[model samples]
Target chain A: MFLAFVAATLVITYFSARKSSGASAYFAAGRRITGWQNGLAVAGDYMSAASFLGIAGMIAMNGYDGFMYSVGFLVAYLTVLYIVAEPLRNSGKYTMADMLAYRLSPKPVRAAASLSTLTVSVFYMIAQMVGAGVLVRQLIPGVSYEVAVVGVGLLMVVYVVFGGMLATTWVQIIKAILLMSGSIFLSVLVLREYHFDLGEFFTRLTAIESTAPDGTKVVRNFLTPGLIFKNPWDQISLGMALLFGTAGLPHILIRFYTVPDAKTARSSVVWAMAIIGLFYIMTTFFGFGAASLMGPDYVQANGGTNMAAPELARKLGGEVFFAFISAVAFATILAVVAGLTISASTSFAHDFFTNVIHHGKEHQPGQEVLVARIAAFVVGALAIVIAIILGPGVNVAFLVGLAFAVAASANLPVMLFSIFWKRFNTNGAVVGLLVGLTSSILLILISPDFMGENAIFPLKNPALLSIPIGFLAAIIGTLLSKEVPSEDKFVEFQVRANTGLGSEKATEH
Target chain B: MNDPQPSAADKPPIDWHRIQRDPDFSALVRSKARLVIPATVFFIVYYFALPIGVGWFPEFMEKKIWGDMNIAYFFALSQFLMAWVLAAIYVVAASGWDRSERTLLAKFGYTSKH
Candidate 1:
């Protein structure tokens, strides 16, 4: 029933998107999006299935630390709000490639920026798709996993092909509101079940999980154990990646472009943070609500700890609540995927076709628009293929962590240095991006999470090692490089990016 | 074609010292900083400090709060409330800075408000 509603929603959204006028509309809702509207959309895009479902599940399982992911995610936007939001809105040409090319020659920088965008986007999409598969299978018990994947893929493509960013952003805005409302409603219901007595609730929750033969209390994993780090180090590493990662995500960064100026961009992050924070708080209740009310026996009977929150909802809210949440979960996945495809398409259209391939030569606006639409379809298809290969073995939440780590390691340093530090030359930008990307990937591959038979390395949690390495690499690379950019080129870039000086006469260079 | 270059004294032709002293520039910096600093501090604590607190004091965190809701649970839930407060703060603070900041940005070669 919920799938039917989402399919209908996607169809209507897709048709609405078909009216996108040009590349601007396709890429960034034609930059006509209102500040409030874009704020909701950004919240929607950033808050994925992992955030909505996984955070609650983790908290239910791991205790306090699992819920930390939610706090880290919301706080991460502070870094975005303070450092990157305005600069990105002030300086970006289109994709992040524009920012990189702003300070240096196109060549390898454009290529590298484009590559980085693709790598992060693909990983992100896989996590979303996998989450969709899991949710769909749960919602409709009889449906095969493969069918769920195909259904989600088709729905996503339909939305991206027709709606562009305009459709996608609105979908995100709606999804964000729905997701927040749904979680709050469920939390309220859960609280009501315990008569708002949280103390009794915890005792009951723990007592239920404490049923061992020897009476040894089996700590119901409220969140996956702090296997990553202990106390301060774990918090610091999570904080570093999440705090900085928001600014680096390609899709999130591009949302600033949909707004009017630096002020608007800044304002949007603040709004996004508030909306995101509210949702995270709601997730904690859902997590604990699941733990206290549903009990360990129910969670273990269903599957394991991950099912705690969802089963708790089933117990409290029953079938109707389950159906509503199931629909919202689908909407969450769709909105995020649509935004990702639009961002990727914009990168292809702006960075590759118009800028690099054409070498600043102007193409017909229609031709550019066509290319963007085509690229959206291509990205959606590629993500679908990746999702199929990943299959059922993957955990959606873990994959999201990987995406956050990679984005923090690679893009944050380059973007930050390019804006604030003048000495950061082209060579340094290229090297910094490469080092960040390589190190994060290397760390993830070898870590215990993705390690073992498929493991690329032996250590887990690369934050302590990889993050510093990336930052140092960027700083050192910039310091060692001697070739300063041409004064004239710098002046032109400054004029175009920083001032309202007359680049309005769009000339084919 | 080679263009004549300015001497060292003539370089940095704009009076940066005068610009710095301008009321408009000072107001611009003050207004922007108000929003930027609080937001930065919040990130430092919420993302950096809160998680560390929980991670370090796991035992204390796992204990119940109102009933079943523990300190960890409360922190996680309160986080979203904090985000909304920060967002509202950002809107009010950023809007105040917009006009003056724009003036500074123009002086520095600002373009494309859209």
Candidate 2:
């Protein structure tokens, strides 16, 4: 089944490669993806292996605290649908930078935006790559971690370098479908185990028996909060990160560009919210199902938290079902990484290489696309090497959290200011990006994740502090700068953003 | 895929200042803001309330409202419903905005095309 999925995706790449020509086609899939298709792709890109394997594992282990992650993830999309998506669709050409550079000076804004984009993407991609390596090594016999990392890296490189956004979109769509099906089926099986009784399922979840690390057997209620997150401030900080972070994600932002217009973009967001909301709700079943059926101790004893879903599948439906769920997890990683690669490469090539270096002028017609393809290769290889060096011992959840922290802090504040605040200037954009990016990373380095008991910052996530700092920096930088806000440009931007007066259109065949 | 004709960059610049001041545009913006601003604030408040409630008042939230289902679990599930409901309302509201956009574009002597 894994081989079949690989073959199917490669076939998709072949077809997309034939059709994906020109910068628009390669970068934005010719702006032709429909509402539901783009919706599925968006969900696919957004729902990484972290959401699937990690969340289930977390819930199986910690219960209600794990479900908190699901709530935050889904709720964050409202920020996207209402504030970010349509304006970004209307104002930006290819990247998140395109929207920022609309009213401000192009070169500096693009440069800062590109740097932040790459930072977030690399942080995110490394986590996924390491996850892929660890998962593949565990699931398949004789597959070493290094080989798995490199293999996944090379496959993502091929997808972005050749087929570009179109193939990546399809891969994500297919993966989303598979993931949804697998979750639904698994949830049904879980319910069947309880005779499809909600009362029975909830009863089982109330008193879950597990053994502690110190060899003491403990009985805990899985339905209660405070199992994993002992710190209220830490939970609030993580909540803020997730609540604001989705709007700032470069990969998710770029998915809006796949649709023809702002209306389609809006519809696509609605579709995605519905799909994503449903999928997350199902996480309740599978997550608690693993806890109730297999027991947290059993899951921990077998292969640990990340193996909760797959182990549940094996127990419920035997080997065949286990293989199917495993393959879906593999597809989930590939789709997410492919989405990340294209967004990073697109920003680097379009924003940095072409606009920053070449002064927004490609010396050759297809030079930008060429540079992006090359960027994909470089980015993929870099991620592979980093993941190998970092090894599977590095905490995947921490890296993912840090990525959200940076996005919420750096990318989001600047993006919101650029669109809404007429006073927002080049100085604000650059300073905001720098301050937000550095503060989040700096805070994390000193936080409990790295510093253990002697940590300077008590919070696990820094968005609660860094996000305010980001917004303040942008405001202060703008007020301090003497750069005259161009009223004409702001007017133009407002007109275009509010009404799709001058938006990118779908490419006709 | 062919290039977009009269792409935003190359198209003849419209009288953007006039459009910004126009009643139709102002109405559209006002209408969207009406739904969006309050909805955004409402959802953000509602969303953060969960963690705050669960974090600060764990004993209260731990009280089972249903068959072994605590208030925390029920509230978390309600978030999914809240998000979907909000999204549906926004989509329905935005369709009106889309119509206003079209009418405004037509008055400006430009045919809006997807």
Candidate 3:
């Protein structure tokens, strides 16, 4: 089944590659994805291994605190659905740069956005690659760590280079299907153990006692929520980060450009919300179900809590079910990695090279596409090498938080301003991006993860502080800077963004 | 006027300010904001309540409503239902906006492709 999936996707890539020769097709899938298609693509692209293995494991280990992450993630999409979706589709061409370029100066805005986009994608990709390396090695025996990392990296590069958005979309769609069905099967199987009685299932689950890592007999109540964040304030801050951060995610935002117009974009977000929301609710089942069936001892003893879902499958239906879910997780990682690679490469080639280096004057569509393909290879190689060197020992949790924080602080504020606030000039965008990026990174670097003994920062996530700074910096910089981008330009941008008048040309693909 | 597009040299002049005055365009914007802004604020508040409740009132959240299932877990599941219902409502609301947009486009001598 795993090899068949890989083969089918490769075949899809082959066909899409031939059709994806145009500049629009290369970067934006010719803006042809229907509402339902784009919706599936969005959910597929967005739900990573973290949601699949990490959160389920979190619930297995810590209980309700782990489930909170899923809630935050699902809720964040409302921001995307309501605020960002329409304006983004109406204005953007290829990258987020296209949206900002509407009002801000193309050179500086694209330059800053390119840097931010690459930063988020690189950190996110490295984390996934490292996790992929560790997980794949364990799941598929005899596959060395280096081999796992390299295999995933190369496959990701190939997907982006050949299929671009078209192939990547299908890969994600397929992954979404496999993951949802697998989770549903797992949930149903778990429920079956209690004769399909949710109440009985919960009663027995909480009644059971499990062993913890410290070799203590523990009775874990998967019902209550406090294992992760003891402090209410910290919980609020983490919630703020996730809620705002999702809108700024580079890979997620880029998918909006794949649809034709604002209408499709809006509808797609609704579709994504339904799919993602339902899947997450089932994940709550997966998490609680794992703890109930396999117990925390099994989860931890095998390989921390990351093994919860797979272990649960093994317990319920033996090896075949375990292998099936493992394959689905593998596909999940691959789809996310490919999605990240394409977005990062698009930023590097289209935004950085074609726009910034060539000052938006280059008309070489073929050259840009070639550059993007090369960029994908380089990005994949770098991520693989770094993941191998890091060897899964790096503190990826901190980096994920940092990625979301940086995105929320840097990207979200500027995007909101660019679309809504008329006075948002180029200086504000550049300053806001720099401030948000640096502050988030600096805080994380000093936090307990990096500084350890001498860490000064109190919180694990920095959105509570840095997000305000991002918004304030943009406002203050716009007021302070003497550079006023032309009024006529702002008017043109406003009209275009509002009315979808002079956005990218649509093809009848 | 029938072109519906700008040829390279002879681009159609769009009176953006006039469109701002056009009832169809303004109505579209107003209706969208009226629905979206309120929905967003409502969801954010409703969503944030769960985390805060779970964080501060763990004991209360742990209070079992049926069997051993706590109030918190049930509340979280309700969010799933709420999200789906909101999406369904938005589809209906968006269809109306979409219709207005189509009429406005046609009135402006543009084709609604679908």
Candidate 4:
């Protein structure tokens, strides 16, 4: 089944690459995707293996605290819709750097933005590949972890290097449908097992009993928080990351430009919110149902919480259901890696190659696409190497958490200031990117994820500290910097970003 | 993707300052702000309320509503509804904003040549 999905996406890449021979087509799918299509693609791009496997596993292990992630992920869309989506779609050509450089000096601003984009995407890609290696190995007995990682890497490279955003978008749309159908099916199955009695389901889920070390009977309620988020401040920090992070995610932000206009961008967020929101709500049933049916002990024995959803599938319909859902999870990773590779490659070719290295010269029709294809292959190779070295046992959820922290801290502040503040100069944008990137990474390195238990940074997520530094660095740097944006630059940007006055027109073909 | 757009520079340069001051533009911006600002604030506060509730006051959040269905579950579920309802509302309100934008665009000669 997984091979079948891979074969289908490769076919899509073949056809998409033919027309995707130019910079515009390669980068933004010729800006021809409709709102609903882009919406599904965005859903596909944003919902990583973490959302599919990690969240269910967390619930199977931690309960209400895990549900907190779902809420944070969903509500974060409001920030995107209200503050950034239309503005980004109107102003940005291909990459996040374009949005930042609208008012700031282009070369330095694009360079900084590209650095941040690559960092975030690479971190995210590595974690996905590692998780994919482990998940694939679990499903199929013969494939070694190293081989699985390399296979995923090559497939993603082909999708982006050839098909670019067009193939990536279609792959994501298919992944979203498969994921939603699988989850909905599992949710129904879970409900049916309890005779569709919600109360009965909850009762069974929470009534999971065990014996303590002293042989005392212990009843564990899987319905509460605190089991995971023992620290109160950690919850707030995580909340901040999830709330502010999506607006800064490069792959997600670029999806806005894949549609034709600002109005389509705005509508796409709504469509995404609807699909993503429904999927997350269904996860509540899926996660809780997993706990009720399989119990945490069974899930933990089978290799922790990531196995919860799959284990529940096995119980519901034997081996066939498990294989189908496992295939869907693999497809989820493929779609995400393809999305990340495109975003990273687009940034490399568009911002770094064209702007910084080539001094803003127009590339011949296929030149930019060629550079982008090479970048995708390089990025995929780097991620695969990292995934192989790290091995399959690494906790990937933290890496994802770190990616969000960096995005919120580094990218969101610059993005918000660039689009909103008139006095936000080139100095601010560059400094914001550098400071946001460094502080979040440094903090994470010192935190428990990298260092052992006792750490320099108390919080697991650095966003609580790093987000403020990002904003303040931008604000102070702007106030202290010598270069001020010319009056014309601000006005032109406001007009373009706000009203879509001079937005890029999409090619219909 | 990298270079400043050629078509934008080639076309008649928009009087950005005039558009900035246009009443229709102001109305659109102001009205969208009116809805978006309050809605954004309400939802953020509302979203934080649940996490804070779960984090800070677990006993209260864990209070069972129906059998083992806790208050926390309901509150969390409500957020899904809140997002969908708010997003739906924003899209509907934006349609009116889109109409006004088109009307003003034609007035200001900002219509697309393509």
Candidate number of the best lDDT: 2
Query: lDDT-based ranking, best first?
Result: 2, 4, 3, 1
Against the reference, the lDDT scores of all candidates come to 0.69, 0.90, 0.80, 0.85
Docking class of 1: acceptable
Sorting all predicted structures by TM-score, with the top scorer first, yields 2, 4, 3, 1
Candidate 4's residue-wise lDDT over B20-95, tens digit each? Answer: 8888888888898899889988998998898789878888998988877889999988988988888888889988
Per-residue lDDT over A1-509 for candidate 3, one digit per residue giving the tens place of the 0 to 100 score:
66777788898899998887677888888888888998898999877877888788888777777777788888888788778877787777778877887767778888899889988888788878866776777778999889989998888888998889889998989998898899889999988888988778777666547775577897866676786677677777778888899999999999988887887888888888888887888776788888777777777777565667878888887888888888888888899999999998998888889888876655764888888899989888888887888775443443465678889989999999988787789899999988988888787778766778788977777788889998999899888988877766556666556566655555655
Which stretches of model 2 miss by more than 4 angstroms?
A393-398, B1-11
Q: What DockQ score does model 3 reach against the true complex?
A: 0.40
Q: lDDT (0-100) at residue A467 of candidate 2?
A: 100
Give lDDT tens digits, candidate 3, residues B50-79.
888887777888888887788898888887
- For residues A75-155, what per-residue lDDT tens digits would candidate 4 score against the true structure? 999999988898888887998898888777899998999999999999899889987887887788999989989988888
For each candidate in turn, give its C-alpha RMSD to the true structure in angstroms.
5.7, 2.1, 2.9, 2.0
Chain A TM-score for candidate 4 is 0.97
Real contacts recovered, all predictions:
0.45, 0.72, 0.46, 0.62
Please list all clashing residue pairs in model 4, or write none if there are none. none
Write the residue-wise lDDT of candidate 1 on A1-509 in tens digits. Answer: 57676766676675666666665666666666777788898999999977876766666655556666777788677677766776566556457777667667676677677767877888888888887877777778898767888788777777777777777887888888888888888889888987987665556555436344475767554433363344466456656767666778999988887765565666677678778877877776787677666654555556344345556767888888877887887888888988888777777776777667876555575776677778878887788888888885565666777788778888888887776566777787788888888888888877767656675554445566677777888888877888886655454444333332222111111
